[model samples]
Target: MNGCRAKGSWVADEKDTVHYSGAAGGWGSVRGMTEVLARERPTPAALDTLRRQNKPGGFMCVSCAWGKPKHPHPFEFCENGAKATLWEMTSRRCTPEFFAQHTVTELRDWKDYDLEHQGRLTHPMRYDRATDKYVPCAWDEAFAAIGTELKRLDPKSTVFYASGRASLETSYLYALFARMYGHNNLPDSSNMCHETTSVALKKAIGSPVGTCVLEDLEKCDAIFFFGHNTGSNAPRLLHPLQEAVKRGVQIVTFNPIRETGLERFKNPQSPVEMLTGKETEISSLYLQVKAGGDIAAIMGMIKHVLSTEERRWREDKRHVLDVDFLAQHTTGFETVKAHAEQLSWEEIERESGLARADLEKAADVYIAAERTIFMYGMGLTQHVHGSDNLTTLVDLALLKGSIGREGAGISPIRGHSNVQGQRTVGISEKPELVPLDRMAEQFAFDPPRDTGLNTVDACEKIISGEVKAFIGLGGNFVRAIPEQVKMEQAWQSMRLTVQIATKLNRSHLINGEVAYLLPCLGRSERDMQVTGAQAVTMEDSLSCIHGSQGNGHPASDHLKSEVAIVCGMAKATLPPNPKARWDDWTADYGLIRDLIEESYPEMFADFNARVFTPGGFYKGNAARERIWKTESGKAEFTVPTSLSALGLGDKEGRWRLMTLRSNDQFNTTIYGYSDRLRGIEGTRDIVLMHPDDIAAAGLAEGQVVSLASDADDGEHRQVDGLTVTPYLLPRGCIGAYYPETNPLVPLWYHDEASKTPASKGVPVRIVT
Candidate 1:
């Protein structure tokens, strides 16, 4: 960790120069090149030993959604996964006495990195506003207080927020607790990122999950990756991409930025490549599309493919359409064909920011492949027309008869480890009729009929005084939500705020009138239940459900399992009723799984027995087999209009800013201070700009500038002193990390269809 420092500043090396320039506030800004060097170094042997996987053992890496290892790489973990692993296995601790000395106000000023770096919490803690400090409290006392506050407020006025990081068993218990309390305001992390995917998939295919599994990826002749950077976001997928490249699979990458992962990836596992310093070439063809332009690009490709099919039919009597499959499994071919024929290339190129030649080239790749896969990420969903973008991709997949094939289907790479699992086990605020009716029949209580508030709506309710309390299961609510000022104010206005967290964070700092921080066990920490030391289950991005057992001891003997804590609070809050059986469930996680099986029998059949498998089982996807689940029992096509009409306007000289994360960061959790692949060290605040745009803005390389959004409120949201880093991105486009540039996004700005905050495509004006 040694480096040169001058007046609290340090010089950066070649690799560190980029990261240091972009470093955000906190440890990233304070540390220099040394942090980058530390991250690149090989992982310690102790960590490798801890991550050992056997036929029956702990859960897989939660950091990325890349499926189980296809061919075992020497390093089982990716860089970001390693960071998450190390952070969870860190040797830091935060005791009750430490909280007693540090007041909530004092901790509020601390950076997010510094606060979390303080270490894991050992026991339950309740804030003492009288002394301006937190004091240790017995579990019973804390539960009683939580029960009292929950009882005081109407069920609808209380929000139960869950993060995707929580275990399936714990999430099930949480949902049960909320349902027993007679509210459905369960705003989990899925609502923020993949709600669009859920909504779009349900509308078009009748299923909310991806149709393709990890193994299916290897079978595709062509893969179209849109709006995702697999290298940094899901590094484990690099191995598959490397394999695909070696097999001569045509990979087409459609993104606004030329991501490093899509460009050239050096597989650390390949002996020759690693030894010779050779890199695997990925993305045979890379197309740079503008933000919010995904729909146009997809439609354009579909149009070109259809045209090619028509030409082939006229020349050789060969049809690209799978006539038998379409007749039996689909319904919207006529409408889709009509729209594709009518779409103008000019409109497509204008909206998608892709040239006509690029669209044709992509279509050529698609037409040549017998089977193809379409994969997308949040970049496709964080726009005003996110649903439209997703629908177009589905349209393309369906047109080529890709669905229900071996290596061909639509895949949405969800971020959180068990994000899909949480949604599966009923963490959704908007429960369909089937699950609700079943829940009522199983528990013998009429489930809440009215649709609940989403993440954004919940925050709005709190700010508008419609909600009086907030209870979070595992996420950093304040930091994750949009409109930080309003979110912070809402937390302060709450009558009670209860956070069941494994560590300290910004959410804990935003204290309520009656605030409590109940320290819980981390995922890497052992959970002791009545049965014995129990392992929690998590569903990976690919729908593989597996068990996770903590190798490390609990931060302290006082820390309780999240499931146990939820049961304790539920017992204290619910009216005297034997049906609740909160006590029996608290002693063992198996009991909770049994209840989940009772509620969702179709999805969780023999949950306990199935979880012991090595690779885990795949949750059934009807669309995977080309069984259309849409209203028409077919994959529907959506005709995309203008991006300008969507209200993502590019005024006179302004550029659209897409926020992304560095390799060192995972969501809001800053692991270290550098992004190695991006050649950035000790920095997260710099903005990536096209070299031409930088020059046009009268800004030189390494020069700092201020960026502001033209919101209606006239609020001066500026990120001052950001160095301009030149990149090969398209002109009138800029990139920066979220939470850092969150201020630039307007409170009301979000996808109209999904209500997800549009963190990706935001229009901003920069000044020198």
Candidate 2:
């Protein structure tokens, strides 16, 4: 491996000390950078004006959606959020002339960072094949062209795609437009991640979202964190963990490797800690479970808890099981107990890479806690049997009667701010019959009852030529999906590809037969609706709905709101109707709210009046109160029969591979090349491997290896030149960043229940 030298710094070799000349001078460098940024370009002072109570406006954070605000603070933005905000607020633009200077083919070769670092899009563009460049197009002309194209294809053949970054109103409008146009083909970013949580939660507890809120974190006596890296993925969460530690809360973490955030954290906010260079202890007990062994670990914990409770009940009159809650609010306990009893400690230890004593200790902590919260991330849901893993967690929560409580429940940390909102507004390609029927009646159009493709299915459809056009409502669609080569090819094969974005990305470079990049305003930019500057709503992980008003100037004067773009496309595609007036909604976002109010009256009641309040209302879930919506009106326990049943790592000697993003990144965007907390720098080629595994493979540290997956279908998938680094990870487990390793994941491989790609648990073998 070669190290690049910084400007004015001599290259160090052998024993010479390595230093970052660019990062030296600490706070002075940061202060100087801020000055440089300000001097480079003038920006709106409105952005500096903080919201009342010093909290960010409820618009979902453009970076990552980890949790919501319970208390206001002067500093709420995380590191990644700061990067996202700074990137959005940059005084740079990519005008039509910039596109005119470069062809799509030429732009395709540019790095992901260079493509987006060019800054925001300044105008709507349409590809001109004759000129081999994209030229500016009037909003009306673009809308009209989209309408003409919509009329040419069958509604089922056209897909309306959405990203998690979209606002609640925008997502609602996108879904309404699709239903009104007679198709339910809504493939979204959720399908690429966390779809398993939705599926498992709905089946086990009769709800799709997490039951715990941010406030609940403070109230919990203990928290069990699974398969998530708080340091990199959810940095803002570090404060809460720090606070919890200060309050004597016990945290038990389960992941393949010990994450820095979960080990020790220095709260930058604390003057004493900052001055003394002291760190807050995070995890009381850290268990390094093997990748794809989350279910086994969870099952082991439950098994221990049950046996201990039984033994105590026999000796003393103490019972760990909430018998009353179980008898009233749940069923199938007998079956669950029978299956759990059959799981031997040996098998559990072998599968989970955790000892019986470790699991017992964790269970003891859970049993002692009056209130506990179980939180997990993609690590628990990126396996072929991810839904089962989720079910197991739900079963544990139910066993302890954690739901409907103030301090305890199951919480799955969502990635995007509005991802939950998108799902709430019906972005799923597979809509329930009730929503479909309600939408059909409300829109005065018969929506197709047949199920539609998810992200994986959508890609397969495009590749097979079954899908014709693709319309994205705010995301890098090509980068988010699995199998990069196939995704790019499928995108190119589309008849028309429309991208509604605030900036340029690799997705825009992969053009269709007719491509259009429609510039849209960002969450931090002012959006002028017919009702004047308006606010958009976003639902946090805890189901608290909040409103956000952009304080910054629009990226471009020509950029439109996502709702406006959807209305424009709908007007062009659908027949003119009195009740479902797409043009009227486009004129003002308030009218869209009015329609939502009329449609989902139960949830969107007083949509206009309630949004003006300081903190938005909460969308109540009956399941959160232990009122199950299942067929039996109770939570159900599902028993996973065999490892093969999950269809992950079924092949011999095949280990499950999970792809994750570094702390410096959000989704497909790579702001920097280093993951500071992980001790990785300069490059993204390093893979996390167990020391024992490296020795077993006869590979020395830093050895380059090719990770490959055998395709039962006779095609080979491989990711080469991965620099292996021995870390404190569970044996038989490995970790690498995504998109770069996405090609190794087959489109056909996915969770059966949720249809989400198994990006977290791909089965592969290592070669040197």
Candidate 3:
């Protein structure tokens, strides 16, 4: 397009930056991992913790939710997982003395990376308004103050938020405590990430989770990946993909950016591959679609498949469509087929950024494969029509009878270790999803049946001064959300805010009128309750539930496990209810598991026993067994009429921006400034764009620019001082780091059905 320099010299002006053109996960991953471990200078205890991570009786990795194999490798941890472990198990500590040195106002200005790099927090601290600093506070006093405030405010105005890092046990207890306290406002990380997947899948297949296990990837003849960056988000999944490639499985990927992780991979664990520097090519066909163009791409495939079916039938009286499977196991095929028939090739090509020939090639691959697996991530879900995007994926699968087979199903690659488990154990805003009758009978209290607030709704209430308090079990809630400026301002209006965390974050600096920072033990630390050393359970992306018990020493003597922290809050807030013995749960988490079983018997039956089994047990899915749990007793198709999922027409001087994570980052937790795969270093405040787009906008490379959201909302959402870097992308698409670019997305710009923030695709204009 413009300024055609050598591929490696795009950033010649910046000394610290260089584009990396090597395959993902070889010596580069090794160097990156060494740097990560060297930051903390691995202690003996930390080394031991690494050895036991992802093991049967050891703690789960506090990272992505990629499934574990039946017999995991000794070093089952990925580079990101190592960063997570060492980041938590670091010897450096954020003590009371550290907080005393900096006031809340001063700490608010610190970068998120710097705040977390200070290491694990070691004491419970409360904000001192008069002094503008945090001082040490006893755990009992903090809980008592929180309880008193909760009792004072209306339950409807309070929210209990959970991050995806919590274990299933902690999530269960947290949900129970919130319900016990007479409210169901349980907004969690899922609301921002995969709530669309849950909403769409349940309606289409009667299951909210994936229908495949780790073995499915091995047996599948083909796999289609959409909008997921495996190298940075879930590096562990690369090994299996490499194996699938070796075994002659066809893999196709559709993403706006050509991620290095998905292009080629060199297995770090393979001695021969690493020594010889040989890399395995990942995707057989990589389609660089425009941002938010997945729906159009899928529609094009459907059109090709249908056209082939009609041509074959006319030529030789042969059938190409899975007619029997559609009649027997699915509904709404006629509607989907009719919709595909009317669509013109010109519209599909224009919207999808793919030519008709490329779509036919992809469709041919889909037809040739006996079994195929469909996997997608946040890119497809973080849009105004996110649910529509997922349901459309299901329609294509059903067209080929891809679901309810051994190696075929729709998979939404989830974030965090236990995000899905948290929802499974009852962290939900919808009251109907909970077992209200069983909970009432078991706990001896009338449960609240009113619908609760999601993250976006809670932010709205906080801004309007309607939400009085916020209790975050884990996560940097305010920092990771939209409308960063407004959310930070609204956070001050809360009467009380409690953050149960292991490390310091930006959310802690954005204090409420009365804020308490409670220090909880990290997943890598030993959690010895009254019973003995305790183990918790986590559910992975494959719907497998497994046990995880910490092996290392606690970071601080004053720290407590998450279950204990939940118990302390519950006991202080509620009067003595004989049936709900909160104290017993702290001593023995098995008691909490029993209660979980009582609440959701169908899913969690024999919870305590099955969870400890080697490799864990598969939580069965009815849809996998050809049993439709949908309202019509069959899989249903969804046809979205809009070409642009966001309902926006083409506009000149506009770019659809998708926020992404760097190789050195996980979610909002920034580890370093360098995005090793993208060849970025020294800074994160840069925007990646196609060279043609930059030249078309009359912007020169390395020029400073400002981006303003193109929303009709009156709010001027903009992020300035971003350097323009040329990259390979579609004509009207750009990429920037998340939480930095989150402001450009309006808080109201989200999926109507699921309320998930459209973080992946925000329309913006560049200002020189």
Q: How many clashes (backbone N, Cα, C below 3 Å) per candidate?
A: 13, 1, 0
TM-score list, all predictions: 0.92, 0.93, 0.97
Clashing pairs in 3: none
Stretches of candidate 3 above 4 Å error?
1-18
Whole-model lDDT values for every prediction:
0.77, 0.77, 0.87
- Among all windows of 10 consecutive residues in model 1, the one with the lowest summed lDDT is 1-10
- Cα lDDT for residue 758, model 3? 90
Best by lDDT: 3
Candidate closer to the true structure by TM-score (higher is better), 2 or 3: 3
| Alpha-carbon runs more than 4 Å astray in model 2 | 1-60, 643-646, 650-653
> Please, what are the lDDT tens digits per residue for candidate 3 over residues 1-768?
122222454434323323567778998888888887888665468888888888777778999998877688878888899888888888889999998899989988898889998988999999999999999999999889999999999988999999998998899989988998888899999999999988999998888887888889989999999999998999999999999999999999999888888999998888999999899999999999888888899999999999899999999987777899999999898999999999999999998999889888998989888899999999889988888888889999988788888888888899988999999888998988888888899988998998899999999999999999999998999888989998888899899999999989989988788999999999888889888988888899999988888888898999989998998998999889999787899999888888888888887889988767777778788999879889999999878857666745568877898999999898989888768887777788888888777778888788889999888667888999898888878888888889888888888889878989998888888988
lDDT-based ranking: 3, 2, 1
Q: What is the lDDT of residue 630 in candidate 2?
A: 81
